[model samples]
Target: MKKKVLFYLGILIAWFPAFSQTDNSVSAITEAREQLVRKNHEKSYVSHILTGKRYDLKYRGAVNSQFFRDIYPSYGTLVYDGVFFDHIEIQLDIYQEKVVVLLESKNNEQFVTIDNEKVSELTFNNYKFVHIRHDSIMSDGLYQHAFQGKHSDTFIKRTKLKKDKIENTKMIIEFVPLDKYYIKNDWGTFAITNKKSFLKAFQNSEAVVSIVKKNKTKFSKKKIENGLLKAVSLLDPLLIDN
Candidate 1:
């Protein structure tokens, strides 16, 4: 199994040079090449290739519809396995919770899913993803990383997909946002559905609550994020220096 994976991974890397020949792919390729030349880190790098079963468009049971159909050819940047790759056109498969990148093939362009375990941080479609340990647990997974640099407190958004039935004849897919706001604080991860809950979760409750109160408007997801950023700025020094 390892040999098979490595073989395909090699093939994928071989095609990378073709991408570099184009002006658009030069920045990312040059960056990766420079890193290979300069960095002394010895971590093993893997370029995941979309194989027969893992390929989404050709998969059997997957819904023909996708969460990111509306947003395609969206160029972005990502750091995978500590190597910087930029100027990538990608689509977010929210249903499968995967980042799909467009790659060139002999026949045409193909869509390949990125292995999330290799992704350190990714940004596209105005959303950011970072590996995080949920609820202060040891296990790390990807979340729409919101606020960073607040050592003890980070804000993130988690998403999931829900399938809705359209009568008995058809179906529709929806990107159901599950608990869009969360505060990973010193205690643990806490969902922020309202102002009171937000105050109770963070040690800097006064600053957080004050921000909310000053808004004097109905609470919203955007407001929660803005408030968290402010509160995090206030709490960053204490959390980081400790």
Candidate 2:
């Protein structure tokens, strides 16, 4: 009886640590999922940038009926022609109710139009900006600018990773060029050389995990401004042209 009692006690002690670890892992995964959902909601705001703009913009949400029917017909090729602007073709991918903006370029012999079949090949070239949660455990800029704007350039591009969960998860935000000159001149080149910016942005933008938990559901203008500034500052070294 004494030996059996000791053996059971040892098993209980071993199982306790395993149970605790499993609980911790589950909590971490749950928190990560919540952070991701918040990030997705925050990204929805990017659409506001195109609210009244004449540029062609598309939206795909997580609905199947009308959304799928509406997007499927345009799957082959989409051409946009504005009186003051040259023609442009946008290749789109509609899956899981998320629309990835594939490519945009001038309709010319030098540029190649994207086809629906080639979307997977072109997705890597596409850029997206998102807001993310971060933990305050470390200090570094969370964003970077790949291209420096010219003197007269009206817009600039920046990319950043907002850290969340002690660097375990990150929200990658890519500032898109709203201005025509910046879009045409700087976008392509920066996309190629600015890979480091992505890493650095994640490093710089650490915040308190508790703060993120408190503010996850609420959107604050101040937080967005601060994050944007930090991201742009990381790009200072690359901003020589501006």
Candidate 3:
């Protein structure tokens, strides 16, 4: 059965010719794009879709968010094994590191999970995330692209966890957010949690710390994002020779 599906997908994927502005060429390209979309749909669904087991929501828990942005499946795009697919219903499970999708078969519907290792890029919530693996400085995981500079780039690792606590004389599980920020340069990737850590990433820590204070940049967890972006822009020129 799997072989049959793979063979079916192979025949549908075809090469495109060089595009021209003529009316006939434009029409041909449109048809080809439509075909490509259809092929992508079939290839993505038929080959990689998995009937993933979902956690029971009946457990006593007051959850805030267990997903990337929305608790429900959001329309997005993903690059799976070098194939680009758009208009896919997906949810990024921050806790379990899973990608769940809603798949409909006839009159029935199910939330299915896809292989995460095959997925390199995912877009939703007006943001882009890339799966980083086999890197020298960074750990293997999904990281959200925050800012890019000539000397360095920044990424965010998003996560959540369920904590058991007592509230109103009842035991309840609450979801908590835990996010980590990283800065990667030619040397290595460093986790910058606060001003101290941010300054530590540079060779001249004392000078960098003074410059950061002079510019009044707060780089703690509360204001890490904007702070890091501003710091990168401020320091990129100084490290241009490095």
Candidate 4:
């Protein structure tokens, strides 16, 4: 009788740990989802369709355009214009021992560092002229039809959960292409003028997203690269023409 009791007790002990782990996992997912929802509601977190110097010069296919090289003084600069009323600049500071992001705009400037060490800085090229334009009337009509109504897919769901001890997480999210619609509609005009620049600029946008998603310290470069690649693969297919 005692032997049987001991056996059952041992089983219970083992079972409890597994149960606890499962519960913790569920709780983590819930928390992550909540965080993502909050982020989605925040204007800063919403994806913007931007038109910028890079877009204009690149779409014009001026491969030799000095503007292309001039914007990125360093490889770490990421610029997005046209989503908001102005441009959004995100700069990664790699000169320091740690990696960080610098976010800047006309009304606000701040540094957001990962792991509390590296500082990212945001800057606007004072020499450059920033032009802000509303989406073309046709593009605006599509935007309303696709995203503004009850059927809108613009508000995407994103979740990130740490999957390994190396501080890397699995991020799953939906991305609606707010810009692609305009691109597709205007493709003929833009492509004819600047095929090379347009292609390069599009590729650059993909690269920037990869960098943002894979920005981390603990993971190997290969692992980070793979993560970014996987993320882009999943999201790219969901982008619509409008």
Candidate 5:
């Protein structure tokens, strides 16, 4: 009787490893299926479409108005919460000063406004925009992304809707406003009031002063975007090092 019992015990021990291996395989397959379902759900649910808001102007790809860049509704990529989404259509709503994206919905396509705070950076058409803390006399600590160097020295082309009356007919005109450049200094941020005031602002930086004096022709008028950008480029390194 004792010999028979020992023989059965040996058989049970040999079967244990096979049973454990089979259970592990089953668990792995179940976990993989669950992950796939979650991924699909995120793809369908994590979308935003604009409705009932007058803030975003419809981007009709018309050349009637001035924009941040010439390209409208161009293919672009956006980064949010450190995740990247590509093959998306984007446009700059200058009137609203926000980056708008076109998203696909079951019924139709809709416009979605991206949250500035969640957006780390955006690349649209040929421009790269990054959020920065801007301080200026007109606005204070306003958070927005312009061209990369725009924070250091800002250049903007803005448009305002104006009414034009001719022969008792009132027509809306896309009025292009005067361009201006604002520079940030240790003292504070302010627009270039005049040639002499700008020179005084950068008076400490001899290199910038010399550049401005050399290209005095450009600063003859109120707006000198290219020259102003060049001056900021030269002084940026010094600002960073300090």
Candidate 6:
């Protein structure tokens, strides 16, 4: 594997001259060259290290018709086996609870899944997620990283429940979200659902509430997290520090 990784990277440096030939100005050439090399390095790492079984596009008895967020792939970054890779094409299968990568070859599209254990952190569609085994904060699985504060942090665990409906003659499958929110500080991790629960988690509810309002954080009852995330972030520093 080590030899393969180097072999793939060796092919990338071979095109270093292209960066200089494109621009006569030194600064432009240097900046542009750095960007190109970085992108190519990511490609090399993705192609070499991240490889697995074919990710079938067709639903093979998947709970919902669309367990995936989108049929198309988006570019994102991830940490695998302590190595960080960026600018790679990816898709999230929330129902299956797996990370899939899209690869291209000879004018054809291919998809593959990375090892579950190797994926520790990932970002896609503007959401950051982490999977920790044996976590004291909550269940040892995937959690959408909502906020990372100085003394504390917040994580949201979202799960899609399977639902079936009859649409005409055909049976249709759908996914509905059931999410849990958590606040973790130096002391412990607590599942906070609303303002009352949040206030109860800390010793001084009034002080935390005051800071949260001062920060102008918003939460409400809707198809949302009810504002606990921003509240936790604003109050953590004030509450934990004192």
Strongest candidate by TM-score: 3
* Alpha carbon deviation, residue 6, candidate 1 (Å): 27
The lDDT per prediction is 0.62, 0.30, 0.75, 0.31, 0.56, 0.71
RMSD of each: 12.7, 24.4, 11.6, 23.9, 11.3, 11.7
Put down candidate 5 lDDT per residue, 27-106, tens digits, no spaces.
65556556655566576565543332223554343335535555458888877656677878876655455667787778
Model 6 lDDT at residue 39: 69
lDDT (tens digit, per residue) of candidate 2 on 1-242? 45655565565556555555687865755565566556665665432211111323322332222222233322232212211111222222222212233333366222222222222211112322111124132112111122333411112223222222323474332222221111112222111113233223333233322233444422233343343334444444344342
Query: What's the candidate order when arranged by decreasing lDDT?
Result: 3, 6, 1, 5, 4, 2
Q: Write the per-residue lDDT of candidate 3 for residues 141-211, one digit (tens) a residue.
A: 88988777788888888888878888899887667888888888766878888877787777655656767
Which runs of model 3 end up more than 4 angstroms from their true locations?
Answer: 1-61, 105-107, 205-211, 237-242
Highest-lDDT candidate: 3
Go through the candidates in order and give the clash count of each: 0, 13, 0, 10, 0, 1
Candidate 3 vs. true structure, TM-score = 0.69
After aligning candidate 5 to the native by TM-score, how far in Å is the CA of 57 from where it should be? Answer: 5.1
Instruction: Superpose all Cα atoms of candidate 2 onto the true structure and report the RMSD in Å to 1 decimal.
Output: 24.4
* Candidate 3 accuracy as lDDT: 0.75
Candidate 2 lands at a TM-score of: 0.18
